[model samples]
Target: MRYIYSTLGKLSAEQLGMILPHEHVFVDLRTPDKPGYGQADTASVLALMVPQIEAIQALGVTALVECSTGGVGRRADLDLAVSLATNFPIVVPTGNYREPWIPAWVHSADEDELFNWMLAELTTEIEQTGFRAGWIKLSAGDDGITPLEARILRAATRAAVETDALIGSHTIRGSVVMDQLDIIEAQGGSPARFLSIHTQAEPDFALHRAIAARGAWIEYDNVGAVPVAESTDLILRALDAGLGEQLLISHDRGWYDPALPNGGVPKPYTVVSTELIPLLRARGVPEDTILQLFHRNPFRAFSRH
Candidate 1:
């Protein structure tokens, strides 16, 4: 059985094959543009996702924790709808507050509005589809959390606490870490439930360790795509510091563009099963250790409401 756990009653970490804790199967920045904002159709989006979905299944991934939030062109209902049809074990869609790299025209949905909408949608999803939401995604740009972002975090915390779902975030490189930590704690969120993406960009073992010490998970995602030596060295450093269990590894991959030569997403960019695990194994990291980072740690941290 896949290990089933929850943050606030929300489920994640089903006992199964490998899981990609944070990723996007389909995203089109063009959807939120003017003239097509609310009018963006689901068919177009699904068309972009189908090929990759097939690829994911082929790669032996039993679950994919999609981090796309509403108001950012990610349709939870549509994604769930498709997942139901495919009978995939899980395709967890995030709630709202998908800022950063947001389309300029996505103005109708602010944090508060998105939060409210998210609650309603979540309820509907549970009642109708029986889809267990494994986690929530919130974002803060390089500047740190704003008032609206705080409101969203508060709402997420409340919902998470109530639902037992884990909270995951995208904190861009720079000074946003403290902001994220503050908001999560202020909302009575346990440090264990927090996941901040891309900590390797700053490469501060001390800082990452501090967060892990606080019971939060710090992701070293997007590192697998770099030169193996450099990436392995960083992973080793984190591990030596006793932070592996707090780690969550991923390529953060799966997107295709006609312009890109491979017709796939870039670094931090590959199907979860394709390159990440193999690269780590080749680098001399034990398979058990890698599984703890990629499979066990994420499941334990993210599922603990």
Candidate 2:
């Protein structure tokens, strides 16, 4: 079976290989009052990241999905640069119409204006810069989708309908899952066109199964060795429930410097490549199963297949 990847505006075919669907090259956050916290210098990011990118390539990781959001330090120019430099097929989202994260100027503007701005960004980046982002990304706080965010979601759905792009999102927990989907579906969107990230953290299988029943892919992107047995078991149980095709696993680890003023987890790739996958292998998870979870599943989940 061959694999295809689309994360940073490029799609390429390759032999069936591992693909980490949720990750970041070097993401930094710029919260208020922490002016120096998140700075995305392309030269520096590429310089520091070349080795890690090469390492992933050498390890047979054919592609990656970079989930950098607006306030979370997303830079399309940098993403395009890395894709070109590394020749890695990536899918970056043309986003930011979501509430609380859309540019502050959007509040004064109508939803249509805000959405049009986001569309412009995505299209400009794709057509002019040669970046080919295939997904639309949005994030929600613990409250699920806010009013403004709902507008963003609708706009994104409309955009996806036109472009045939997929939708991927960050919903905090199980309680809000249905509500999140409500907005998407209201706009004529469905689970098949969406990826619900961090499903393993939702507390039970019933909730995940409910989501899958609706046709969305439940993403286990943040799973890792940390947080102990709970995380590991969450994944194992999900697979055991016969929901493998509906799942996509990743370690959402790459964004923090404990040494820096702010603290956060390291990159997801480091945890998966260095520790967790090996641990799972040592624990006797078959290579083919692991391959399907980390590779084929994600491709099918995000691609318009």
Candidate 3:
């Protein structure tokens, strides 16, 4: 039997209804270089985020995977609060962010120490929050996997294998997708449990085909930000190549930016159901195929069997 850990508690994978594979509930993307940025008040965040989640739930979305990790305003307690308020199950992650967002402590720690930290987050409660992470999140640069990022990736792979958790990597331009996979397999991690995020940014269909053939999952999650036609085209292309089982989709949306007046225009999470699904249907995508993308694939990718 397989199960997924939510901010609230454990849930069977089958119990996870229509899922948004990648999203951020409360993220402060502002950098240290810019002052007065990346500041989020918990009360303010919950005040705004709870209603957005409730709106998503009204659209029939039962669960969501919050990809915001350490170094990026990942408040597990806030996630739990929203989940409880909306009665929605949210699967939060544990790991480090990209090079720019990574903290100094991550650089000081050795690979073994990093692995232990991530392992503990998966196996136990995160930083006394009493909320265990459901999966591991990692990010690589556009040029390639940097040396430090490689250490994090290797450590994340080891932790994922030990915890039977999925490893979702943010691969900009999809340049290092294969390299990440190589490292994971080298460290005894299963490629089937690895997810290559932001694949739509990479235009190489052949490369996408190769990655899917290797038993890794491909995610085209920039829905609202990217043109719907282009996003759906990529999904259809992958499905045509018989990679539907390994494909995942989401808006990659949501952010309560404190910089902007009134939270910097919070993007709605309903685009997947309201806009994308209708577009896919208009393009002749069958209902069953759509369900597979929105439901079955996410369960298989995120569930620990």
Best by lDDT: 3
The window of 10 residues in a row where model 1 has the poorest summed lDDT is 1-10
Candidates sorted on lDDT, descending: 3, 2, 1
Q: Write the per-residue lDDT of candidate 2 for residues 1-305, one digit (tens) a residue.
A: 32232534334344446778887765655441256544555665666555556777877777777787665656666666776778776566666524445556544667677567556655555445655555777776676667777777777777766655667878767667677778778877666777787777677679899888888788876655455345566667777888777788777755433224333334436566666677667766788888788877877766642
Clashes by residue pair, model 3: none
TM-score of each: 0.77, 0.83, 0.95
List residue ranges in candidate 2 displaced over 4 A: 1-9, 12-16, 31-38, 97-99, 114-128, 225-230, 255-268, 282-284
Q: Write the per-residue lDDT of candidate 3 for residues 184-276, one digit (tens) a residue.
A: 989998999899998887888888888888889999899999778878887788888998889999998887766776676678898999989
Tell me how far the alpha carbon of residue 238 in candidate 3 is from the true structure, in angstroms, after superposition.
Answer: 1.3
- Give the CA lDDT, 0 to 100, for residue 187 in model 1: 77
Off by over 4 Å in 3: 32-38
The predictions' CA RMSDs to the true structure, in order, are: 4.7, 3.6, 1.7
Q: Please provide, for model 1 over 12-38, each residue's C-alpha lDDT reduced to its tens digit, 9 standing for 90 to 100.
A: 454455667766654444435445433
Q: Where does the lowest 10-residue lDDT sum fall in candidate 3?
A: 30-39
Q: Which regions of candidate 1 deviate over 4 angstroms?
A: 1-15, 30-33, 38-48, 98-132, 223-225, 256-272
